[model samples]
Target chain A: MGIIDGKTICQVALVVKDLDKTVEEYAKLFGVPKPEAFRVPEESVAHTQFKGAPSKTRARLAVFDLGQVVLEITEPDEEPSSWKDFLEKNGDGIHHIAFMTDDRDAAVKYFEKNDMPVRHYGEYEGGNYTVFDSKEKLGTFVQVKYEPKK
Target chain B: MGIIDGKTICQVALVVKDLDKTVEEYAKLFGVPKPEAFRVPEESVAHTQFKGAPSKTRARLAVFDLGQVVLEITEPDEEPSSWKDFLEKNGDGIHHIAFMTDDRDAAVKYFEKNDMPVRHYGEYEGGNYTVFDSKEKLGTFVQVKYEPKK
Candidate 1:
C-alpha cells in the first residue's frame, strides 16, 4: 500500500481589509511585480470554501511573490470576512497555511482516519476543499483540496 | 553601506495545550521525530523557545526532524501567557509567523515611514519582534524579527 505523508506548507492566505493597498504594499516591500488583482463576486462565495456558512462575500484577491511560496490576500466585502474576525479577535497574524496534496479526498480521509476533526465549507467545480481544524491538534487550519483547476 | 535584502518567514510559534501530546501528533502524522524536550520554568510561563528565546516568552519546543524549522509551543502555569490568548481567540490557529530580518529596526522604520500602523510587542535578547498591523496591508499581522542563535 502506498504510504501517506504530510506535506510542507507552501502558501499562506491572509484575509485583508483593502485589496489594492495591500497589493501595493507587498509589491513595494518585496520589490516584485505588482500582484494581479481579481474580484470574486458575491455569487462565487458559496462555491469557495470560506468561513461560516455559504453567503454573499465579495472578495478582491492578490498574490505576492515570496520565493518558493506566495502570500495570498483576499479582502471580502461582506460580514467583515473571516480575515477581519481573526484580526480583531487575535490581532493580525497568519490566517491559514496550506499544504499541497495530490488527492484532497485521500488527504482528508487520512486526517479523518487519524481522528482529526475536519470541516468542509463547500465544494465547487474548481475543487473540493476542506479545513482540518487542527486548532485542537496543531493550532492552525490546514486546507486540502483535489479537483479541477480554474 | 551594506544594504539588507528581503525578509523571509523564519519560524512559526504556537501555544499548545499539551506539549507531549502535540509533539506526538506531529511526529506520527508528519513522520517527523520529536526533538529533545525540556522545561524552562524560569520564564513567566512554563516555556521553551524553538531554540530558546534569549529574552523571555521562551516556550517548550519540539523541532521537526527535517529541521524545516522549529515549532515553539508555550504553556503558562503562572501568568496569563500570550500563547493562551492565541489559543483562546483563534482556537489553535497560527499564533505568529516570524519573518527573519537582517535589520529589524530598518524594516520597522520602512513601514512606519509609510504610515502603516504597527504594534511593537517589544524585543527579546534573542531577537526583536513586532507585529506590523497589516489588516489594511495584507489582512494579516506580519511578525518581523532578527534572530541569530548564539
Candidate 2:
C-alpha cells in the first residue's frame, strides 16, 4: 500500500500576510460567518520543532470546515516554522495539504526513504503532526497528522 | 447567502515545473497508477481568453480524482494564461481551488463587485470556467465552473 493509503484529504492550509483580512474575504466567499482567529500556543505548550531543533514558531489561525476538507488560514510570525518559511519564500499561498495517517512514524520514514525528509513537526492536544519536504516532488509540502488512540 | 453558496469544493489545481515528474511522484504518493498527461487544446478549440483578450495559452495537465476533491497538476507553456502567470510569479504551487456554481455569471459579477475581477476564462468540452484574482485577499485564485443543464 502507498504510505498514505487513505484518500481523505483532511486539510488545506494557506499562509497569508494578513490574517483578519483574509479570513473576512474567505468568510464572504463561502457565505459563512468569519470564524474566530486564534494564535498558536507558545512554544512551551506547542513544543514546535523545526528541522530537529525546538523553535518558538507561532501563527494566527482561522479554520473553516468546508464539509469535504478543512480550510485553514494562517499568518505566521517571523519564526522558523514551515508556515513562516512558505510565507517568506512564496508569499501568501497554500502551504500544505494534510492527510491523517495511522502510523506517523512509518509514514515519515517512507517519505525520508524517498528523499523527502521531515521539515517541521509539532504536537497539539490530541495529536502530533509532521511536515515533509516533499515540495521537490509534490510541488507542495505534505503534512501528516497522527492522533493515536488514547 | 455567500456568493459561492456551495460547500463542496470540486477541485484544487497546482502549477508545476515538470508535469511528468510531478505526476509520477503523486501517483506513488497515492498508491495509484500514473494517469496519462494531456496537452490542453489550442486556443481555437479551447477559446481561451485572458483579461478579456483572446490568448493562446496551453498546458500539459494530469488529473487525479481523490474522491472528495480532484487534484489537477498543470505545466503551462510560455503563454499569457492564468497558469503561466502563476508559474512565473510563484514558481510551482497551488494555483486555484475551484467550486461548481450554478450561476457562474452572477458569481463572477459578485467577485468583480468585490474588486476581484476575472483574470482568465475558457470553455471545456462540457462547461465554462472563470478564474478570479482573489489572491490578494484569499491567498489563491478561486475558480468557478458552470455547466448548464442541457
Candidate 3:
C-alpha cells in the first residue's frame, strides 16, 4: 500500500498570533463552543525536533472540530517552532495539513522514500508521530497524526 | 442561527502556479486519482464581482475529496483575481476555507455584520457564493460555499 492507506486529512493546523482571540473568532465563525486552550504537556511528546535539532519548544494549542477533521490552532510560546516561523513570515495562516493513521511508521518511511523527510519525531499517547518536511515539495508541511499503541 | 448554520468547513481551496502539476502531485500524495481539470465557465456564474467591480475573469479549477472537506486547486488566467494575488504574494498554499450553506444571503449579511466584509461574490451552478474579507479578522479568508436557487 502507499503512504496514504488508512490515512485521512484529519486536521488543518494554523499558526495564530493571538491564541485566545483567534479561538474566539473561530468559535464565532463555526458557531461552535470556544476551544479550551492549553499548553502541550511536555512529557506527552518525546523526541521532538525543530529544524532538525532536538527541541524543547513549547506552544499553546487550541483545538476544535470541523466535521471529522479538527482545526488545530497554535501560538508559539518562547519556542522557536514552525509556528513562530509562520507568524514571523506570513503573520497568520494555515501551517500544515495532518493525516491520521495507525501505521505511522510505515507512512513516514514511504514519504521519506518519496523525498519528504521527517522534520520532527514525537510520541503522543506513547505512540509515534512525525512531521514531514513537505513545504518545498507540497507548498505546505504534513504531519503524520498518530497515537502510539498503549 | 449564527453565521454558521448547517455550515461546516467542507473545502480548502488553494491557488497553485501549475494546475496539472499540482493536481498530479496531490494525487500522488493522497494516492487518489488525478482530478479532472476544469474552468469555472463565465456563463455559469452571474453577478460576479472582483475587487469591488463586475468581473469577467476566468480561472481553471481542479477538485478532489480530502475526507469530508474537498480540496480545490485553482489557477487564475491573466485576469486579476484573488488566485493571482495569492500566487504573487505567497506562491502556493491554502487560500480559503469554505463553509457549505443553503442560506447564502443571510450568511453573507451575518458575516458582514460581524465585521467580516464580503471580498468577492458570484453565482456558480446558478448558486450564490461569497468570499469574506477575514484575512485581517481571522488570519485567513473565509468563503460562504452556498448553493442558491436559480
Candidate 4:
C-alpha cells in the first residue's frame, strides 16, 4: 500500500498565459456547455511562497471536473510566480500533477526519500501543500495537498 | 453540440525523451504497482503521416490509467516524427489532447472549420486518427481518434 496513486491524484494543473482566453478555448474545443473561470485570490492564499520565498503570486483559475480527475487552468499574474515561469519557458502546458494526501507528513517523507525535494510550501484555506521540484527528473512538478478539517 | 466534448477526451499524450525512465519515475511517484512499457512499431502505423507526408514515427509507449482519463507516455524514435518535433522543440511535456471520435471525417471537418487544421493523420488497427495543429492558439495539439468497427 502506498500514499499516492491513480485514485489519489486529485487534479492536473496547467499554466497558461491567458486565463480567460484558455477557458473559452477549452469550452469550445471540448464542446462543454459552460466552463466557468474563477480567481484564486492571492489574499486567500496569504501563505503563498515562490522559489522558497514569501511572495504573493496570484492567478485566475478555472477547474474542469473531468470525472476521475480535475483539470485546473491557471493564469498567473504579472508577479514572478512558478506558474508564470512555466508559461514563459514552456508556453501553455502542464505545470504540475497533484495528489490529495490524507497524511501530509508521510507523503513529504516519502517524496524526499525518492529524491524529490519540496521547493515551495504554502497554505490555502486551512490546508497545507508542498510543491516538489521534480520538473527536471519528472518533466513537471508534483504537488501533495491536504484539505482543511471541519 | 460541439464535435468533441470534455467527456470525449480519452487521453493526454506526453512526449518524453526517455520512456523507460519516465514510466519508472511515474510508477514510483504515483505509488502504482507496476506500469510496463510497450513499443509502438513503425510498420504497424503504415498509414502514419507527419506534416502531410508518409512517415514511420515509432515510440516507446506506456499508459497510466488515471481512472477517468489515461496518461500516455510516448518517446518518439529518432525519425522525423511529430512526437520528436515536439520533444525537440518543447522538451518533455504534454504534446496533445485526444478525443475518441465517432466519425473521423466530420470531426476533421469540424476542427478545420474552427481554424485548427489537421497536420498529421494515420490509421492503425482499423481505426483512424488526426492531430490538429492548434498549439499556437490553444497551447497544444488536439487529436481525434476512432475505434475499429465491430
Candidate 5:
C-alpha cells in the first residue's frame, strides 16, 4: 500500500473569472501559444489541459508555456461555481495544486487517516479524481487526479 | 528586452494556519516527508518551500527540514504582514503562485504592458519578488521572484 502511494503533480489549475480574456492575456504576456479551452457541463467549468487535461475538463482553460512546464488557467462557468466561490471567498488567487497518482485508492487512504477527507470525487473520460479538502489538512485543496483504465 | 523574457513557474506559496499540525498531516497523508519548518522574521510568516509545488513543496523554509515543494501554512505573528492579510481576507487557502526569472524589471514590464501592475514587492534570503495584481490581468496574482545573480 505504501509502496504504490507516491504521487506526481500533473497540473496546477488556476481558477479565473473569464477564460477567454485570461487566455488572450496569457498568450500575449507569456508568449505561450493559445491553449485550447473546453467546457465541462458536469463541473460547470470551461478548462483546457496543458496538452494534458484536454477532453477530461471539457474545462475552459488557457495553457501557457512556462519553460518546460505548462500553466493551465481554468475558469468556472457557473455563478456559484467552484471558481467563482474561490474568487469570491479568497479573491482571485491560487486555487488547487493537482497531483497525479497511479494508485489513487492508496493515496486517498493515506490522507483519510490524517483527518483530511475527500471533499469531492470525480471521474471523466479515462481519469479518476478526488479533491482532498486541504482546509482541514493544510489551507488548500490537494487534488489527486489519476488515470484509471476502466 | 522582449527576447530575454522567459515563461517559468518557480513556486506557489500557501498561507497555512498551524505549521506543526499541517506538517504532520502532509507527511502522513501524501506520503510526503515531514517538511522542515522555519520562521521568516523578515517575511513575517512561518513557512516552507516545495521541491515540486505539485508533487511536493520541498520548502526551503525558515527552519528545520521543513522545506518541500510545500503546501505552505502561514500564521500571523504581527500586523503589517502580507501573510496575515492573506489569511484574514481569504481564510487559510492558496495565496499566490510565483514564477522566477533572471530579470525582475523586465518581467514586471511585460505584465504592465498587459494592464497588470506590480502591486506588492519584497526581498527575501533566496531572491527578490514582485506581485502583479493579475486581478486585472488574469484574475489572480502572478508573482515574479527573481534571482539577481542570474
Candidate 6:
C-alpha cells in the first residue's frame, strides 16, 4: 500500500486574497447558501507551528462541502505560515490537496523519507493536520489530516 | 439550481513541467502503476479553439482515477492555450477544476453572463470541453466537459 492513500482525499484548498468575496462567488456558482468565513482560532487553541517552531499563523477560512470533496478557501494573515507564503508567491490558487489519515505521524514520516518535509502543522477541534513540501514532485503541496474516532 | 453543478466535479487538473516525472511520482505515492503520457491530438482531430479562433494548442497529458475525482496532469506545449498561459505565469500548479455537464454551451453562457468568458474550447474522441476565465472570482479556471449519451 502507498504511505498515504490517495483515494481518501478529503479536501482541496486554495489561498486567496479575499475570503468573503471568494466564498460568495463559490456559493453562487454552486447554488448553495453562502457560508460565513471564520478566523482560525488563536495560537493557544490551534497550536499552529510553522517550519519547526510555534508560530502565530492564522487565516480566515470557509468551506464548501461539495459532496465528494470539501473545497477550502483561506485568506492568511501576514504571519510566516505556509498559507501566507503560498498566497504571497502564487496569489489566489490551489495550495494543497488533503487526505485523511489514521496515523498522521506515519504519513509525515513517509513524505519526509521521500524528501518532502513538513512545512506547517496545526490542530483544530476534532483533528490535527500537517502540510508537506511536496510541490516539487506533486506540483502542489500535500496535506494529511488525522481525526481519531470519537 | 446552480448554473453548473459543482458537485459534479469530475476532474482536478494541474499544469506541470514534466508529465512523465509527475505521473511516476503520483503512481509511487498512490501505489499504482505509472500511466503513460500521451500528446493531445492534432488540431484537425481536437478542433481546438482559443479565445474564439481556431488554434493549435496541445499538451502531453496523464490521469489518475482516484475514485471520486480524476487527477489530471498536463505538460503544455509553447502554444497559446490556457494551460500554457497558466504555466508561464504561475509555473507548475493546479490549472482548473472541471465539472461534467450535459449542456456545455449553456454552462459557458452562464459563466459568461457572470463576466467569465471562455478561454479555450476543444473536442476529443467522445466529448468536448470549454475552459473559462473564472479565476477573477473563483480563484481558478473552471471547465465543463460534455459527453453526449452514447
The lDDT, on a scale of 0 to 1, for candidate 2 is: 0.87
After superposition, the stretches of candidate 4 with alpha carbons farther than 4 Å from their true spots are A126-128, B44-46
Residue runs of model 2 more than 4 Å from their true location after superposition: none
Best by lDDT: 6
Q: How many residue pairs clash in each candidate?
A: 8, 1, 1, 0, 39, 0
- Per residue, candidate 2 scores C-alpha lDDT tens digits across B1-150 of 787853768888999999999999988888899999988778888899888898887788999887678899999988889998888888889999988899987898899999999999998889988999989878999999899999
Model 5 DockQ class = acceptable
Cα lDDT tens digits, model 1, A1-150, are: 121244455566776556677777777776666768876544454464444456455567787655445577776665544554555655545666665566666776778787665643445445555666665676666666555655
Residue B107 Cα positional deviation in candidate 1, in Å, after optimal superposition: 2.2
Candidate 4, lDDT over the whole model: 0.77
What TM-score against the true chain A does chain A of each candidate get?
0.71, 0.96, 0.86, 0.86, 0.72, 0.96
- After best superposition, candidate 4 residue A108: deviation in angstroms? 1.8
Model 4 over residues B1-150: C-alpha lDDT tens digits?
Answer: 667766666777888888888888888767775577876555656577888878777667888987666888889887677898988998888888777877787888877887888788777666777899887667678888898679
Q: Write the per-residue lDDT of candidate 6 for residues B14-70, one digit (tens) a residue.
A: 999889888888898888888878877899999988888887877899998876898
lDDT of each: 0.57, 0.87, 0.76, 0.77, 0.58, 0.88
Off by over 4 Å in 5: A1-7, A41-59, A65-69, A79-88, B1-7, B41-73, B113-115
Single out the weakest 10-residue window by summed lDDT for candidate 1 chain B: B46-55
Instruction: Kindly indicate the candidate among 1 and 2 with the higher DockQ.
Output: 2
Model 5 chain A: ten consecutive residues of lowest lDDT: A46-55
Order by lDDT, highest first: 6, 2, 4, 3, 5, 1
- Return the lDDT, model 5, position B17: 62
DockQ of each: 0.30, 0.73, 0.53, 0.58, 0.34, 0.77
List, in the given order, the native-contact fraction of each candidate.
0.40, 0.74, 0.44, 0.51, 0.48, 0.66
lDDT of 4 by residue, A18-130 (tens): 77777787777666755677655565565777776776776778888666567888888877677887888888888887778878888889878878777767776677778
Worst 10 residues of 1 chain A by lDDT: A1-10
Interface RMSD of each: 4.7, 1.4, 2.5, 1.9, 4.7, 1.0
Query: Could you tell me the lDDT of residue A121 within candidate 4?
Result: 71
